[model samples]
Target: MTFKPLLAAALLATTAIAAPAFAGTKMKTEMSATPTSNIVETAVSVDALSTLVAAVQAADLAGALSADGPFTVFAPTNDAFGALPAGTVDTLLKPENKGTLSNILTSHVVAGSYDAASIIALAKANDGKAKLTTLSGAELKAYVKDGKVYVKDENGGKATVATADVQTSNGVVHVVTSVLLPK
Candidate 1:
């Protein structure tokens, strides 16, 4: 089979074995030491972050994302992309839509390192909500309910943080099940 099919199978197997790997793992410094670049280098890295990875490379943001950012990225998984409306991913991947795709992906990222506590505090301070400005010039609103963090976009679409605090050398990553669309 082709690489994409093989990759999908591998990812499925890994997912079956791990079943939300970030959910139970504590944020250890050693685990955190896994460089974002290295993650991007690994065999299944691109598969796990298929859509966002493509967008990053297409947008020429790979170097910036691999740099010493201390950024906080809310990464959507392959399943999240699969859940998108039919043709959405294909359209985003087109050369003409590269800029738009990049903007949407980068909109999920914030400039500095923000841990869960910091995020929660920001939410509480804003009357249980916080508006975060992303590197892409878009805004994302964060709110905490029942101790779970939820992010909403300008278009009013929301995605819950399914797993949090997946730390990387360059930044922290929170896994969200759905894509957060920009207005």
Candidate 2:
């Protein structure tokens, strides 16, 4: 029962007991360190983009989007799909209309990475409208209305960027209020 041996044992026991609490804090930090999802995964996670996700799958565009892409997508919400004329979305979903659906979806996609600030600057340079050539070979005009960016399609259909610059692993998504139709 020497004092030195007793003190050494006490120190060892204290360290061993305190290690678990520090380890528990480390585990909590690790749990929160989980990375963010990519664009397609982000779309799936959002409740508003369900229809857009379905259309992407139906058009066979999911794989391309999910893969490496610094793509800028003007993602339309489910309410945007619902805003179409009666039976429009159902008709587009038909197998025979896959080509048309593909075209429509592609028109909403641009080749490069365009965040809201850069797009706004481009618009400012080009007379308040930035002409973006889409993946479908169609042109989309980005303009600012009431200080918010809006992308206009060929048919005079306008989709407001209701939510701007949602950063993803591959690219950015500007959630639009309306579906953009190809001319």
The best candidate by TM-score is 2
Query: How does candidate 1 fare on TM-score?
Result: 0.75
- Candidate 1, residue 45: Cα displacement in angstroms equals 3.3
**TM-score of each candidate structure, all chains considered together:** 0.75, 0.79
Clash count in backbone of candidate 2? 0
Each model's number of backbone clashes?
0, 0
Clashing pairs in model 1? none
In candidate 2, what residue range of length 10 has the lowest lDDT sum?
25-34
lDDT of 2 by residue, 1-183 (tens): 011111222221211111121121111100010024466766766667889988888898888886688889989989999999999999998889999999999999997788766887798799989999999998999886655567899999998776665666788777788999888
